[model samples]
Target: MIDILLVPIVLVIILVMLHSYFGMEILKRGIIFTDLAIAQFAALGSSISLGYFHEEHFYLLTLSFALFSAFLIAFASTRKLHLEAFIGILYVLGASGIMMVLSHSAEGMEHFKSLLASDILFTPPMEVAKSAVIYAFIAIALYFIYPKLSGFLKELLFFSLLAITVTSSVSLAGVFVVFVLLIAPPFVALSLNFKKPLLGSFIFGWFFSISAITISYFYDLPTGYSVVFLGAFLTALVVLAASKKALEN
Candidate 1:
């Protein structure tokens, strides 16, 4: 049981590292909603799959759906018209669809509930392994492509990474807190501008992760919500301090 809990927490650390890295890039590009939208879409897709498939195949379905959604969103962003409105519409429709799917099936409701609020404490070792592998692939892809990622392509890759991170984290931490994993570290890195953005992001992510997990362990708070609140508070402090420093300068 201790092992099971540790696995997911470790995976969450890795996920947050990757999220912070790409999240900083996304923040630089001004397309934060892309993460939230893709996550919702992946949830919607997974719910639909659960209605038809059994538990064993659900992970594959989730990965496939998330990747597909990322591709679609990336493609849409390249168009002349602003894609924010379209992505917003998709988020609403996807969330609605998830609720509808949950309402219709009995067993599906249990799965949906789990999906809506992840049991990170009881997350399977297999799931953690899978997440680790996925995160590695994303990290490698980002490293190689990063030099070439400029202009629209850069924006697209950042959005794609955000989508992947949010969808995966939402599955573990719930969608509500995925926002924290997406936004907070970047804000911390931005405020500090500590010479190396990636290093700053990793430090901030570790700080937020450790603080949240400790609070959850001692206070019996919801881990996800605790992380989000702590991250938000820290981010707000950083922003305010940076603003004051800027004013003085």
Candidate 2:
């Protein structure tokens, strides 16, 4: 059990640390669904690669589509339009596009389910290491380059980095897993007004993710969806309870 879970535990910890930062920033911008839209687009690219090309060019296509979505969202951010609504529309379009692409594939439904959430318990060690390297580079950029940018350039860089992150994460953990990791723990930390919200997010994310992994291992449940379910369910309960208390007080 220890050997089996060690890689996954490390992967989840890395995911939570990186995603919590973006999740906090996304919440601050009040564009909650931007990550979802970008993730959907990335999934669309993967679907295209699977359906038409037999999974060749998967990374290239996924990164390309994710970057495309990021560019559109960044542009919309500078416009006078309803940004959230626009992002919602982009999400739907990517979703519908994915369905259309995969409609003819024999493994269409299975592929779709995997896109939504994969069995991260069986994730490859090499893949985890690769993603970690990519994330490290992204973190360096965010620390140095991101702080110096302003205006539309800043928005583009931010979303582009997010797209890159989602592209890798979507392939590894699936879309809903990425979304939850990007939102849930951060949402809880922000709602509770934690001083070091990122640290709080890491704690919450690690708690739910590790707990879910343990439960899934013992119960023979799907690991990715287990994480998604526990993260979402627990975060929603916490936020709702907090909101109710705030309203009362």
Candidate 3:
């Protein structure tokens, strides 16, 4: 059991560390669904690879689609159109595109499910390493380049980095997992009105992710779905607690 879970737990921790920071940024910017839209597009790309291309260069395809969507959103963010509404449209369009691509494949439903909720328990070590490297590079860029940007360039850099992160994450943890990881933990921390919300979010994300992985392993449940369930549960609990605190104040 220890051997079986060690890799996945480490992988989840790595993911949490990388995503929680970005999640805080997303929450602060009020573009809550941006990651979801990018992830869905990445998943759509994956579905296309499975359905038509026999999984050839699947990651590249996914990254391409995600980056394309990211650039579109970045450009749109500067436009007069409502940003959130445009993001919603992107999300829906990506989702519908997935269905259209999968409509005729024999493995359509299964592939679709995998795209939404991947089987992280069976994730390869090499994939984990590659993700770590990509995340590390993004982290470096954020540290060095993000602070120097202004106006539209800053927004573009942020979304582009988010797209790269989501591209790798969607392939491993699926869209729902990626969304939960990006939103729930940061939400929990921010709802509490923490001064250092990113740190709090990192802790919250780690706790839930570890707990979910353990519970799923013991019960033979799906790891990705388990994380989603636990994340939602924790988020709800935190929101209720925050609400109660607000009422008290």
lDDT score for residue 62 of model 2 = 98
Candidate 3 segments whose C-alpha is farther than 4 A from its true place: 244-249
CA lDDT, every model vs. true structure: 0.72, 0.96, 0.90
What is the alpha-carbon lDDT of model 3 when measured against the actual structure? 0.90
Task: List clashing residue pairs in candidate 1.
Answer: none
State residue 110's C-alpha deviation in candidate 3, in Å: 0.9
My TM-score estimates for the predictions, one after another, are 0.82, 0.98, 0.96
Per-residue lDDT of candidate 2, residues 140-187 (tens digit): 999999999999999999999999999999999999999999999999
lDDT of 1 by residue, 62-102 (tens): 66666677777777777876677777877787788888877
Better of 1 and 3 by lDDT: 3
Model 1, residue 5: C-alpha shift (Å): 6.3
Candidate 3 residue pairs in clash (backbone atoms < 3 Å): none
TM-score-wise, the better of 1 and 2 is 2
